[model samples]
Target chain A: MIGFISEKLTGYLLKRETICQEEYEIYLFGMAQFFRKILVDATVVFLGILFGKAWEMIIFLIAFRVIRIYAGGYHAVTPFGCYLLTILMLFMVLLSLHFISWNLSILTAVWIFASVLILALAPIEVENRPIEEAERIYYKRKVRVFWILENIAILLCMVLHLRMGAESIVLAQATLGMALLCEKWIHGDVRND
Target chain B: MRKGVVKMVLKKVAYHEAEKSAKIICGWFFYQPKLPNAVKKLRKF
Candidate 1:
C-alpha cells in the first residue's frame, strides 16, 4: 500500500509539474500535503479502534488534526511564538490524558505535542528582497524535489505503522517534522509555495 | 521534388506546435519564474 501511494503521489506531482499552472500547481501540492496528514491521522485512529484502543485513537486524531489544520492556516508566527503555543497545547493534551487513562494515551499525547512543536519551530526565513531569476528557478526545483521525497517518506511511515505498530506512526510523525525543518532551511520561508 | 521539401517543413511546424502546446499546458499549472526561458526554448524547437 505504501509503495502504491508513493508511486501515485510522485506521478501526480510530476504530472502537475508538466500540465498545470505554477501557482495552481503549488496550491494543489499544498492541499495534497494537508490531506496526506489527515489521512495519516485517520489511519492511526482506524488501527487504534481495531485494537480496541478507541479512546486513545480519538484523542490522537483530534489533537493531531486540529493542530495540523491550524498550522496550515497560519505561518506568519515566528518560530518562538509557534513553540510557545505548541507547548501550551501540549500541556492541555497531557492534562486530558490524565483524565482519560486509555492505553498509551499519555504517550500518544506527548507524541502529538512534540510533533506540533517541531513543525511549528521549523525555521523558515524569507528575505524581503526579490529573488534573482536564476535563484528562483533553482529554488523551485529544490522545493519540488523536497516535497516529493517528503510525501514518499510519509507514505512509507504509514505503511510501517499498519504492519508494525503504533510506535511506527510516532516515528513517521517525527520524520515528517524533520523533513519540515529541512524544507524551512532550504526555502528560507514558512509560506507554503 | 517540391513535395518532399513541403512535407519536411510541415513536420517541423507540427513539432513546434506540439512543443508550444506542452509548455502552455505546464505553465498554467504553477507560477513558473523561468517561463520566459521555457517559452523561448519551446519556440526554438
Candidate 2:
C-alpha cells in the first residue's frame, strides 16, 4: 500500500517533470518511508482509541520513541516485517496494561533496573545498519540525555501520584531494555564480533 | 486544473515535500526500510 501510493505520486511527478531523473529514486524512497510512518502511527493511535487506553498508549509511544531514536534497538529486516512487529508489540503492551496492575514500589524498581540496563548496553547496531565508532559514541551520549529526561518525567509523575503516567514511562523503559537485549542476542554484539 | 497550475503545485511539492521527507528519514533511527543507494549518496548529514 505504501509503495503503491509513493510510486503513484512519483509517477505523477515524473510525468509533470517536477523532479529530474537523478532524483527519482531518492524521492521514491523518502516518500515511501513517509507514507509507511504515517500509516503505522495512525494504526497505533487507532488501537489506542479502540482499547480505551488512548492517553496511556500515546504516552508509551512518546516515551518509547524518544529513547529508541538514539538507542537503536531491534529493527525488522523488511518494512512489512517492521510494521507487523510494531503492531504486535503495541497489542501486547495494551493487553498487558489491561491485566497487570503494578504497585508504586514495583514500578519504581522496574524503572531503575531497566534504566540502568539500557544505560549499560545501548546503541546496539544491526547488520543491516552498522554504526561507525564516532557515531556510536555520539549516539551513546545522546541516548543518556534522553534517558535522564525520561527519568525526570517519571519522577514527576510519581510525585504527582499519576499512576498511569508513571506506569507508561516505566513500561516503555523496560520494553526498550528488552529490545536491546533481543537485538544483541539475535545479531550478536557487533562491537565485540 | 490547467497544466501550468498543476506544474507549479507539483514543483513546490517536489522541492519542499521531498526535502522534508528525506531529512526525516535520514534524521531518525526509526524502523523503516533501508534507504536506497541513491538517497544514501545524497545524504548531507
DockQ of each: 0.04, 0.31
Candidate 1's residue-wise lDDT over A1-193, tens digit each? Answer: 4334433543554454532443333333333333333454455556556555555555444433322321222222232343344434334433443454434564456456645644454222233113334544444454345434433543464466532234333433443354345446566443455
Residue-by-residue lDDT tens digits, candidate 2, A21-137: 887887676666666656877887899999999998889988887778677777777777777888888888897788877886788788888987799888887654566677678
The TM-scores, one per candidate, come to 0.26, 0.85
**lDDT (C-alpha, whole model) for all candidates:** 0.39, 0.74
**lDDT comparing candidate 1 with the true structure:** 0.39
The local lDDT score (0 to 100) that residue A123 gets in candidate 2 is: 81
Instruction: Give candidate 2's TM-score.
Output: 0.85
RMSD of each: 17.1, 3.4
Candidate 2 lDDT over residue span B1-45, tens digit each: 697787666455544544543333222223635546675554345
